[model samples]
Target chain A: MKVVYLDNNATTQVAPEVLEAILPYFHDFYGNPSSMHAFGGQIGAHIRTAREQVASLLGAHPDEIIFTSCGTESDNAAIRSALYADPEKRHIVTSRVEHPAVRALCAQLSGQGYRITELAVDKDGRLDMEQYEQSLTPDTVLASLMWANNETGVIFPVEKAAAIAREKGILFHTDAVQAAGKIPIDMGKNTIDMLSISGHKLHAPKGIAALYVRKGTKFSPVMVGGHQERGRRGGTENTPSIIGLGKACELARQNLSQENTQVKKLRDRLETALLNAIPKSRINGDTEHRLPNTTNISFEFVEGEGILLMLDLYGICASSGSACTSGSLQPSHVLRAMGVPFTMAHGSIRFSLSIYNTDEDVDMVIEKLPPIIERLRSMSPYWTGDK
Target chain B: MWEYTDKVREHFLNPRNVGEVENPDGVAEVGSIACGDALKLTFALDENQRIKDIKFKTFGCASAIASSSALTEMVKGMTLEEAQKVTNQDIAAYLGGLPQEKMHCSVMGKEALEKAIENCLGVTETSADETAGHIICECFGVTDQDIERAIQENRLSTVEEITNYTKAGGGCGSCREAIRGIIDKIQFEMTPQTAAKAKLSNIQKIKMIEETLEREIRPSLKLDGGDIELIDVDGNRVMVATRGTCATCKAADITLKHFVEKRLRDLVSPDLVVEEVTQ
Candidate 1:
């Protein structure tokens, strides 16, 4: 059976054009971009062109795009730089539902004496603006927000948040790893001082990402020793992968308008069929603001892992709410943060679509999934007669 | 997913005698969602005190659900007394063996059975009396005097070695210091430093090791119906092979780690590692 790949939120398959552009760099055109020799100077020109392509996607200046290893590294650099820029200020503000990369980093910083205020979100995974406003003080140095949540696919008001942070004179950073390619982002139009983006979330390979730092922003390098990215990010460039990311960004920008509409329709059809065929199954986040290509739902009484296993047997790729933390058995922290009850939390699953998905793929999923849920629910002890 | 044994998967997927008996002679319930699992056990008792039918309803992980199912299957033809002796280890052993972390699920089954038995007796099950005159282990506040007498009477080797005989020091490990205190006091009184000068012969040392194992370790394992055999004697370092209920028990490592080693080290020599001889 052909596998239906629906875990785009976790990562996306590299686009064909992006892969073709990157292959030449690995063998025939291989050269050190920093090398002064003619053989290497040609590769350095490709790097500049790639940077401009990525910059165009985000409406950022080519100089603002500083390549990093991955989204987490970019988030780390941005948050750490904000702290370094204003050492006297000791407060940071962020949301409770941030991905572990940001959440864990903030948690570690909190232990090191930074007073972090984790703003709470409402049931739809939207943050409270009132709490965001109250969290700011003279000591607040940064407001780190995410453009979109990886788990629920709920979009945050990043532009409004940047405006708020600007009024407070606090630097704003966004982990836009999930939003960069899926949605329209114009950093030039927003008040965002810094933003983080990853390659894997788009149609680019892993291990390459970038941090966009607006010009004239007070910046400090978290990683020292090398002069790469103009001493802003210090690491030997991952030439092939970075080149792939740039090409992927260009393709995503080219096809985004049409692919977004097509993928959204596929997602909608899948959601509609599953909800109609199964009782008590509904979307988990605000439908209107959620990513057009992602859908998270809960099937009451049936556990997510059990359904996932059955789906796995049929060659379907998906994600569940269970997080294997070092030796503790608990449901997802994200679902729990949203105040989802334990009974329903274990039943939540995420299906993130990509441009590679098709109407037939949606139809196959719609045809195959309800029976799997029905089979698992039949064996569940908590199943009510309504099901 | 848990790497469940074939037997465990079979029991969980097609669990035996699930759901409650309409009119049960006795009912036993233990654990709750707070503890991550809960079981409701019901039994149909025969005139001869045999279990005519056994049924259970469990809301837990796969191992927990499987343990309950396997327990219900094992106890149907057993007398109430025989069923009472069917320990958590027997439940785990019946299902090929559970992972160490899921050992608590099998234990929950035993607790539910015992609770059902106590319920059948119509006397409120005695809470393991928290505020009492009996002093166990000072480390975990297990009443020393009660647990000490139980240890002497029951022949317990180590502290977790005693959880089978007495549910102390199993929570938070605060009572271990108190247990060590008592063990030190007893050793000091029994083997006074002068006894070391008396020169324990190699035969006597070996006999002392045998006595400690037979008296202390075996009985504790028997509570779970597990047994251990002496593999070889090498001065203070002893090798033992766990068997029966313990051979495949998940906490068999915990048994060897905290209990077996501590006992042999205290009774035989301080240099004992208590290595397990596989097969």
Candidate 2:
């Protein structure tokens, strides 16, 4: 079956260029970057170049880019570093619709006596700027928000929010896991203190991510071992994946415009066609303010897992915010936080596109998805075919 | 993705019975749209009072639809009594076992069958009143009885398992303590003699008060054309309501303090007080 891969926000296909760039690092150049021998020490130069490449993508100094295992680690390091840097401040400000990486960590912090002000979102999954501004207090050590939501693809005004946090003298971090590669970001233009980027979200292999810390930010190390990553992070580097990530970042920078134009068109096409063809369906996020490559649509009455399984039969990949899909009896926290009606929230499907997606892929999804929805709705007890 | 067996995939892809039967003898609806799953089942009876035809309409996940489909196929030619014997485990086994988290789907099939049978027998109202225990999980509309039954049927040992089977603690989780209380009570009952020797927790005490009311006091009250309902158990104070003739009887307070309190103190704990609340 031809896989019409649309679930790019979850992960992306590793680019051939990235694979080629990392091949030699595995076998012939299998030497630690920290070794004293020249054969291994020369690998450090490549690592520097990789760091510079990643830094260039984020518009940060090469010294500010710290390579970590993945997005979760980057998020953890950034949030914990802020808290550890300011022990007197016991309050943290964040949004309710964050990815589990940040959301779960904040929850744990709350259990440990840190006051967390989880700002609520509007019905369209857009955060209220006034509520956000009010959430930042003098005692708030950090305000960690996501640049874009993984489930709904709603892009937050992180740069604007960061400026507000800056006025309050609070550290601001953004988990750009879903936003980094798809959108253009320049650290030089924003007051953001730190940002996290995952490689797998950008056609790079998994197990590689970068944390961009602004210069002169008070940092505390999460992993305390080797003096690697200038003591900001520990452990030996994932050499080949890091190199691959560098290549992927270069490709992402080159393809950024294509992502905004070509991928956005495919996403809009799929969204428009599906909504037109299917009744009792609506988009789940703020469409105008969302990522260019993603759309979340809810097919009411039918469950999301049923729709996903039917789509799987046709070799079309997507994801859902349904309770059954996540093994929790409630729909996704993101959807629930947005105040989406439970009827629609139960059947929310997210279709995230990438630069590799084509018009044919969009067309294939449009052709296969409506019938699947019709079939599920037909079987649904609540679907009376009235709407 | 869930590791659904080929059988589950088969039934989900091509569900056996997809719609309602015309002028069906038995019909039932379980779950709700807000709960993220619901099922409507209908059946027609044959000459032998067997289920001649059965159909289901489910708004849920793959496992839920497959379970409903598999259920109608399983109970086709069976009598209502035999069909009543069909457990959620049977439906799950029919699909080579559902994922533990998705076990509630099979439970929904079983509940729909039970309710449909009650609808056929014309005793749904009585059964509904009996099963209308206090709502423990407000998010899922799961009653205490529902959680207890799921625990007993599935041999569930933890609150997480109860959620898997009945969706009791799968939402805001405010009812987790209530679910834990139910589990403790059932576990205590499973090993009653052993639990009796140990110092009772507050939940165990509440369970004992309920058990004593149902077993010792209610039957005696019913013998006199009256009934009783356990209202609340707060510490040593047990609040109950005399129902039917007992509610208006002049000796209701005497019966509460003398018979009910005395029986509870003897059977459950030494320091027990029963107070009758007029409804």
Candidate 3:
């Protein structure tokens, strides 16, 4: 079967270059980075290079990059460290559309006595800047928001949001897991105190991620152990995965333009073709501001999970914000937050492409998806097609 | 991805009956676009009042569409009486089995079939109005009676299970407490008079105790930099120990008697007594 994978925002296939760069660490540099021996010490230099490589991608200081297990760990560490550092500031604010890494943690924090303000988004999945500004209270410790929505791929004004928090003397963090590789992010010019990136999203192996903490940001550690990550994150370093992540980041920096151009064109073609082919279908999220690789489309009356199953049979991989796909009865919280009608919300499908995807993949999807939607719609009780 | 059965996949890929019966003797629709899945069922009756043909138009997940497809095949040649005997379980069983969370899809198929039979008989057994029953779940528009029937039939014990069977507390979770209350009421009704005295399992008792303390007692205690922990639940007596400021508060005994005891009685069994276990 020819697999047509379009669920890149979930996780991605590890780039061959990244895998080649990482595999040798398992055999040659198996010595712990924290060991006193020269074998380990030599490994540390490579790690330093890896740090610099990741730093170069974000335009961050090498000293500021803290490698964690994944984006969830990075997000947890960022929010907890900020709150722990500023115990007096009991209020925390974030956008409602944040990935569960931030949203669930913040929700738990609210139960633990810290105030949480989840800022709402508009119909286009764009955050309200005015409300964001008002949300920064005197005791606001930090404001964490995502750079892009995983489901909708709607980009946020995170740089401006970070600046607003910076003006209020509040620590700002952005979970840039979905944003970092797709969009150009230069920390040197931005006011974001902390930014998170998951390695797998950018073609590195899973279970490796980095948090970019601005130089001299008041730091507190989520996990304290042996002197690693400059005592920011602990436990012996994930040597191979970290190296892989750094390689992925370097590749991401190099492919930034290609990602925006070739990948964007493929994504646009997929969306435009899908919309044209399917009736009563409309795109979710803001068309002008989405990530270059993603397009969320809703085929009304025909549920998403049904369409996904049909697509799966054809070896096409994608994801859905529909109720069934969410492992819960409700539709995607991001779509629900945007006030998307239930009719469309249950049928919303997210097609996120990657640099590896070609025109054939997009065209194949365009040809395959319409028949599936039509078949499901023909069976749909509410679908009269006359409307 | 859902672990769909091979039978479900087969039915979904090549549904047995995919079109409506022409000039059908009966027709019915259940669910709506807002509800995420729906089914429109139609059937024609022969001279002997036997179902000559049956077909369905369904909008939902694979299981939902497959269940509808399976239901049509199951009822095609059966009499209306035999068709009326079809349950949600029958539909799911015809397609091997559906995921427990997707049981509602089969349930929808059964309901649509029942409504189709009712349409033929000009009966008023099933009502789809919001006024017919008080809406407990505003998100799915599930009513109190709908929830009660689902509980009784499915033997659902948890709000999560109730949601899986009927999508009651599956939305914003605002109706979670209401759903829990209904589950509790249904369980109590089924409990024998003698069983009511010891209705809760050890797991259930511990869960109920922990939930009561966390929901009712923990917040006020935590606000005072204090906390309560359930040491053990031994029959009707709940052994608890306090931590933080709660351990040494001057009003500790009064707080235990007045606050903890009252809440435990209201939510859990009335006979539950909170006894503080000293460190």
Candidate 4:
């Protein structure tokens, strides 16, 4: 059927090289890195090397990276731990467009006597720096923000936010799950005290993520148990996935430049064709400042789920802004926060590219999508006028 | 991947009768893509009052697309009267079975067929005037009397309960207030002065839920005509039985979690939990 996958923001297929790197740990190299046996000691060396590989990608020291279960876990740990690290400060500043992993958790914290200031974003999904600056207070303990939005792919000014927070002596954490592999990130120079990365967002398997706590930064362990990652995290090490993530990070560092140029061009080509071919279609975020491999577009008078189903029929995978959460009738909160009209919000579709996607795949979507949208619009009562 | 039945898979994979018919005798459409689906039905009527051909174009999920395909194939050689009688249930039965939430897909087909018939007859596709006036379930534009009768016919128990029989008030829910008004009107009409003297009874509430389900919610699911079973009764907690199509629907969770649970809780009991029975 010649399936074409474009839903990279949701999750990515494991890369062959990353798979090869992880296979050895599953078979002959299986051993607890914490044990005193020779086999365990040998595997411990491999774990150290993997740690270095991941650290190199983020431009952090080897001891700074602590592996977690996933991006959500890391986000929870970072935000909650920041408050614990500085108990006197009962205020937190963040943006409204953060993933539910952060937003929902923050909302939960709001019930526990913590004052949260949610900064607003512009219509194009860009955070308002002026509003962010004004929201900061002496009581603000942490400024947790995302490097890039999952739904819109709009890049946030992490460096600026970190600098502002550092000037105020407030700790900063950036959920870089979507930005880690797709963009150039040098955490060491950004004043970013803490950062989070998810393996599934790249090509490593799900249930593997890492938290980057810069050396000398105050951090409290969210999980309490064993002395893994120097007690920063607890539980038996997910050796295979950790190793996979390390390999994925190394690959990311190697291919990031090529991806920025080549993958970005492919994504742009797909966006251009879609916007040119489909009537009443417009891009959802700032095209110039988004992730190289991501694009979101709204097809007016057409619902996202229907468009997604049509694309599914053609063996083209993507995501939508329609009711992103499990049960809510409303569309994506990111779009809603951007003040996007309800009609347009429901019609938005996200197409995220990866190194694996090709021109032929984009061409297939370009060929198949217009007729589907036109056909759907023809039946729409709301789209009575010329499209 | 979902375990789609061979019939469902076939309809989804190689959908029958897709795309719009060019300048047809009559075109009937429902469920726009924005509403998660849209259908365009074109039919040719013969001199003998039978349908010569029926073609459809649908933009929706697998169930909706498949239901429309199955429906166009099912009604090709039937008379307008016979086609009008072809319910979403009949469509689901023909396709072996559909999931419960997808049942709305089949109901969409029935609605399209009815609308097509109305279009063919040179009449403005008005609401049925049998025992009902145009007391549309403003949320989804379903009539009042139709809801009243559906409640008596289907034994519906709650507002979410009605979606299984009729697809009323299933839209944006702006129509629910109107539905409530209609319910009170029907009750008052049933017992003139007693309406003012007596409080609305539990039986009356349950009856209203049944009517809403049959007239409004059910028809929507019937588009795919997946069977929804009434599981059990525990005080206000009504356990539903979803089989055939609904038994394995992906959004069956969504149907049970949001649509079914919310509607029932809002209209009948706020503490109700419309749980899906594990197979």
Tens-digit lDDT track for model 3 on A98-208?
999999999999999999999999999998899999989999999999999999999999999998888889999999999989999999999999999999999999999
Model 4 residue A146 CA deviation in Å? 1.6
CAPRI grade, predicted model 1: incorrect
lDDT of 2 at A32: 90
Worst 10 contiguous positions by lDDT, candidate 1 chain A: A322-331
Clashes of each: 14, 0, 0, 49
Model 1: per-residue lDDT, tens digit, A1-387?
899899999999999998999999888888887889888778888899899999999999999999999999999999999999989999999998898888999999999999999988887788888889889999999999999999899999989999999998999999999998889999889999999999999999999999999998988998886888888877778899989999999988987785569888888888888889988877777787888888989777656655665677678888887422112345666777788766666677899999899887888789888887776565455666562
* Model 3 interface DockQ: 0.60
Best by lDDT: 2
DockQ of each: 0.13, 0.63, 0.60, 0.13
Report candidate 4's interface RMSD in Å.
5.0
Which fraction of the native contacts appears in each prediction?
0.07, 0.95, 0.86, 0.11
TM-score chain B for all models.
0.57, 0.69, 0.68, 0.56
Per-residue error (Å), model 1, residue A244: 1.9
Chain A TM-score (model 4): 0.98
Segments of candidate 4 deviating more than 4 angstroms: A1-3, A86-92, A107-118, A137-141, A168-170, A301-315, A322-330, A339-348, A367-387, B1-6, B9-34, B38-59, B75-85, B110-279
TM-score of each: 0.76, 0.87, 0.86, 0.72
Each model's lDDT: 0.79, 0.91, 0.88, 0.78
Classified by CAPRI criteria, candidate 3 counts as medium
Best by DockQ: 2
